[model samples]
Target chain A: MRNTWPGAGGSCLAESITRRSRLLAAVVGLGVLVVGGGCGRAPESTPEGGGKRLTIGVNFETLQTEYWVAGFEAIRSELKKRGIDVVDSIADGDSSRQLQQIRTFITRKVDGIIFVPKDARTCIPAIKAANEAGIPVVLFNRPAAETEGVRSVAIVADNRKLTRETVSFMVEQARQSGRKHKAMVVVGDLGDANAIGRRDGFYDAVKGNEEVVEVVSEVPSEWNQEKARSGVVNGLQAHPDISFIFTSSDFLFPAIVAALKSANKYHKVGTPGHVILGGFDGDATAYQMLEEGYLDATGVQDVYFEAEQSVQAVLDLLAGKEVPALILDPGFVIHQGNLHDLKDRMWGARVMGR
Target chain B: MAIGMRVDGWLPGWLKRGVLSDHLILWLSVAYVLGMAPWATGFVSVSNAQTILAYLLPVLVVSVGLTLVLIIGGIDLSVTSIIALASVLGAKVMSGEDGWMAGNALAVPVGVLVMLAVGLGLGAVNGFTVAVCRIPAFIATLTTMMFVSGFAIWVTLSRKIGGLPAGFVMLGQNLWVATVMAVAVTWLAHGFLSRTLYGRWFYAVGQNARAALVSGVPVGRVTFWTYVASGGFAGLSAILFTAGLETGNPEMARDNLLDVVGAVVIGGTSLYGGRGRVLGTVFGVLFLALVDNSLNLVGLTFYTITMVKGGVILGAALLDTARTRILARTG
Candidate 1:
């Protein structure tokens, strides 16, 4: 279902649009050359009178999600604060469009590029295009499929560590309640490296405790709410003895809650037979669920921090400063005790005004 | 006629007639479910049936419109975007404390109407472009699809719109009601396409638009109204989808265009346009849902599930081609 995950563009329509857009870009490029006498700079790049401004092209996978939109906004706003000229393009979840945009960025002769890839594997050509153009490319949140020929710095939250911490909290809660941890694991699209790493982290934590901590079902929901709900219903029917629930992303919280309620297994922290719910992607929804005592914990991936660091990385590259090839920002775990304090710190609260 | 008998020698006359041009998919769907019984758990159970039905409802509903447009020799790529637009509009009306219809009983009905109107408006645009403006169906609908999807994103600012009224949410969450609605809608579409003069015109236009015009069939009106119905149903589906998820997602059916087109084409509808039926689409959707459900039950990975779906669509298209040729040769 990764092929149909959140922000994945329409297949036929996107390919067709990309063909047309590429031709249009060529026409626009010719016009720019005629008007500016091959200035090799976007009109948005204004001279600040102090020094030459650095123009960075930011490519987003799809601006359809609050997370990506917020992250992009943070990056743009932060860069603007530092007087950096920004030009952005949205791929709408099509990797081909993303690759094409990279070429457009290269043609525009931007100083650097920031890419949020739809599929890590489909981004190699995009990274290569930037490298061939001698523009520094910064991979944000998602890594490129093949980094061998691509000279880029990847700034992503450590999803595996986040999931391990969240899953560990769920296990600890189950053990404290003296309940055998018969858990149902709802996974996101395995096509996403972050999702796979999170799932691996869950298994890593419960590795040798198979006797006490049992994984009754593993649902690959691909981060779809309806599919996740259906999976939960089917899983509950197949394994009614399940005592805990773990989700790879907090976006599945609604589906998990609905399914749990339907099965009459949803309850507060102290209630008997209550299904201890733990999730990843600490957003406003997860915090709300946590404050309500429905969700036990969530590992927060600091998307704002990821954006800030990505902007900084691209700037460093443009400045000819040494930066790490991979910058790992392992996020924190949030529970009831810290939910109140971290409510405003979440990405949703900051950008979405949730 | 000869091919039908050759394919199923032991079948009764009525079933043989069904197995050739139209009902071939229904029989195949039945056999598929029965065959997969051994490997998948609860394939024949009531709960499993409910799951399959619920999963197919939105696609089935939208396919009715697709079937109509396809019958008239046109395609609507904007249906998926229409669903998202309608869902967001409906959710917007009913969300928040000062929201238009937050807690009122009329909120649900009004929300439903607004969704339908939005869908109809978008559909009419596609119809106008294809029929009146004479743009290629592919380019026209594709443009609308991108525009509508982009507008929806702008309206919601790419955020999830939720807190819908409880009554409105029930349209999708209530399994029994949604099932009944799907069946009823399918029956109505079948009746409309078979019993009405407009239905005759649908086939006439699809068969040959110029010839249909010579015979005094208002090709433009028929094509326009067909798109209107398609968009209206997409709106209806938005209500169901939003209700089911209890949230308005701009990407609600971003990937469903293929599913709808596949079901329609698999149901024996010619992609080049003209001959097809809603009854066949009913089985087509069921066939797809069964494949997906059974594969999931058997613990097959998503990659494998996707391959199976693609293979099924290809086989169905081939069967459709074969049936058309056989009928042409026999006649």
Candidate 2:
């Protein structure tokens, strides 16, 4: 049956948030004026530059992804440790509202803003405002789709590096097993730049490796387990591959696992055959699969490290120091042997208080 | 005898065609046969049925909501985008991934209520503009469609938020729960329209807005509430989606709106509204789920699926047109 779609408070939430934002800005401005009056200094663009106050803004596409929560908390904590004031504005995943929040941040006169833009194109206006306001930005997780001149340093896991290496492990497994042959690839939302990168990375590395003709069929699962699981079901029926299978992310590992389990791929020749399915991210299932000697391997992207690097990038930028274009490599591959000890490593459990 | 009856000015051409071509019966048989064939090639077994249903639940729920709105002659283009909004918001409010029990319990009430309110509010906007300002429902909802979809991606000031507590897993992960939700929405909506006064008004409004107005019906108010009801259902469907994902991303439901509307229309429901039953919408939804699930088993590319879906819609429209003509001639 056809169902309807719902939303949040209409004009009420909009009107209220607007008033609250304006009021908060006014209050922060007055407080700044009083502090500046006593110090007898114009707003030192970089407040923390010379024994001063600094406000850092944390802009999230929306605080809805678990990985980002730990990542953002780390950014907030690290910046706080450096004596920086953290002002976070969650857009709830609305691109326009996010643009509005960025504008609001600029109006609030924050020293620096950390943005996780939902839409790369919609980010221009907001990024421009922050740039014009002399606020440096650090992007976390995914970068703006096409950031030609957006003044931001993205502290993401070397996505290409991670996926390429993980696929290499699967290839090596197949080589070691003497079952070097064909493979199939199940993918996520093609619209996402991240998914595109992961898919291309895996295909590029695997396609030319051998005569292993991989049939890559995509279902727009969009990183969801159900959809991914369904994609696996589709793939199994479509291609009777002679080799490895790769799902783009660790989040999809469980779904791939389910698809394999249902297909009884677990029944093939002595032990679970050399049919390896790969994933990306450090989610529980990805780690568990390694612990149980499940599929092949996964590429781990530490949320905490990404967050810490984002903070460092902002600090270095503000200090007028040359910041390296660093790609933090989160550790990868969890096999049956080390699964127990890595329980706490799944999320930033020990790192962030959350 | 039929020609003689018509000659007495007792029937119009369309009416004569309707009695013969209402072909609501064909959608199910056709959808089922089409759905089963690919799966029959040793791909889709009964064990896979549960798995497919799990994947289909969220979409099914949204389709049901769209069905209700379609009957009232209103459309909710924002259903997909609103799903994104609810999923994200629900995730943000949850305690963590396993927080399904308490987290979803509390969140469900709040999320559902907010969705309901938003649904009504948005529907009111469409209804008001369409009814009061004389805007087409399609145009009004389309504007809202753009806004909600933009909101799904734009929110969070640019960060992905996730922490659904363990409790939410059961809320949507449980097949029974999802099924219950689907049935509940369809039944409530069905009851409201088929057995209630408000429902009749929807039919009356759809049958002829000017006639409905002249006949002492609160045409504008009915139209407005029709949208509100449609939106409320959208919110409910979104909440279910958050439960299913165990994490909400604002961009997740961006592809669902058209599918939901398509299901409604495919179920033998007229775009003119006031004529289709919830049963028809339900069957339409099931037929779609069958097609979608079966397509996955056959491993068709998304592009192929798109073509199939588009073809299905066009075919349904043709069936509708053909039936009306046949009924006019025969009945």
Candidate 3:
């Protein structure tokens, strides 16, 4: 009776099973191919000299942004010139994965480790593991939590101070416009230390300039362009008189531009009704906008400087020299006035083939 | 009499006739809009309406297809990933910056085709795994979601591609164009579900695959095509989002998955399958869009808005359960 049914017939059943077997084979074959391709890269050989070449393990939070990509490339190229081998892994924003990668590096007995943590506090265990393993660790571009026992060398930009300078530049521009201004601050993910520091910096710069700049809206972007666009549109609708805008990062410039253009307010700096714009991360978009007279200022993090410092710290640690617990890159604010002179120093410009 | 029957008996004739019970979300949405207008600045303005519509269109387009998948007792977690992959691939075809057909007049059409192709292709992969391999839809779609997302990021090196030709971008810029597209898609989907024989097969397959097969329905074919249709819808949504943002972003629509799924479920769609309506999904999307816009205008923090929206979805779900029980008893 079952075999007599439409889908339950013997021929149909046989064909179904055959098709399922074929699909299983295909899926398994594809998986093997992917895994094989991922493992194809060979490790670097020893240098020409007779001396044993040092191997360093570099762990990254994510390379999704141009800033992180530039930093990673700078570190790799710099280490390559000195004949050092680097084994790197990216956690892709998973703190637990970052810890596991660090442990793997410790197991491999790498001479040193440089890692950008996903979270300030969750990374303490990774640092502790490296410390116990007697491997020198360098925190690259992101500082770990201020724990009592865990120790590591941190090389990062002064995020708050740099953002304060950047926002102050915008405040000055608003002051010079000779009228009180409504402002919007596009805040990043609050969980990130750098984002919090930048938010504080905006507040710090706007503290005494209340008469010139009144912040009417704080659009929480959460580091996503879609969220940034939506928040900016809603903020603009609520407060259409907004004449000043600052984003936590430069990657969101595209979202801001779209929102402003939709509202017919995306004008150049000198144009009437132009909104004073400022951003951090000094990415390629910010550089182009500043050059085109649409952006007022951007906080430049000096990726090359940070990368060089991180590599130096690792090398110094390997030499039995005591490196500073904290290495600060006092980043500068790049604006239209200084853009021409500092174009060569800006990593964004460098990435743009300038 | 049962408690549900007693409750139904006190209601007005229209209420007892199942109008309110069937379209509860619609009434709740209307009440929300009227109630929020007084408190949220610009909540009733034309400009705010445009803003809400812009935000609503992409989510609506994606949810319309998701409604079908849910109706057939399947779920596709790869819809957002499809949007991202399609957005970037399509942008690569039509972008003014070193695009394949950069200066060509057919750039927009070709780009649209590529985006749809990516969506359909990925959807086909998902369908084959689930229908042919007999794998669970959840696991198959989840695997596709992860791989497609990673592939998209790899394709662009995590960089957003800009310089999309103005002609392609104009589709996103014009509100009327987006509205027409969304409405046409929704109307067609609604008709297919309400007035077609194949659509009836989807419900039968979802309700009981064995029974559907006994009734001479091609269960595997129906399941396969439902996922393909979903993929096509997600691809169409990618075109709107890419054009609207004026860039091909690998992370496009990454945060909208929860919204799409939540909206569908909140609109009285049964997660266990065999029951849903396209009209219900529309009201669900509208309700979410309204809440999001009003909260943003009121200057509430993102966290606060998220909490409020979660509460509203929970309330809607609870109301759906009560309404179902009451209707079953009264009938």
- Give the count of colliding residue pairs in each prediction: 0, 78, 0
Off by over 4 Å in 2: A1-50, A147-149, A240-243, A266-270, A324-354, B1-331
Q: If you assessed candidate 3 against the hidden native complex, which CAPRI class would it receive? A: incorrect
Which consecutive 10 residues in model 2 chain B have the weakest lDDT in total?
B40-49
Identify the runs in model 1 with alpha carbons over 4 angstroms from their true place: A1-354, B1-21
Per-residue CA lDDT of candidate 1, range B77-192, in tens? Answer: 99999998998888888874445777777887888899999999998998899889999888998999999998987787555565676677667756657767777877888998
Which structure is stronger by lDDT: 2 or 3? 3
- Candidate 1 reaches a DockQ of 0.02
lDDT of 3 by residue, A1-354 (tens): 000112113233333444455424432332222122223322122333467888788878888789888888888887888888886767655443455456556644578999898656556657866887788999988787576767899998888999999999999999999999999999986656788899999999999999999999999886889989999999999999999999999999999999999999999998998999999988899999999999999999998889899999999998999899999999899999999999888899988984
Query: Could you tell me how far off, in angstroms, the CA of residue A63 lies in candidate 3 after the best superposition?
Result: 20
TM-score of each: 0.51, 0.49, 0.52
Question: Which candidate would rank higher by TM-score, 1 or 3?
Answer: 3
Per-candidate iRMS values, in order, are 24.9, 26.8, 26.4
lDDT of 1: 0.74
lDDT of model 3 at position B293: 60
Q: Better model by TM-score, 2 or 3?
A: 3
Can you write out model 2's per-residue Cα lDDT over A106-179, one digit (the tens) per residue? Answer: 54467788878764444554665577668887777766544455566667677676788778777776666765
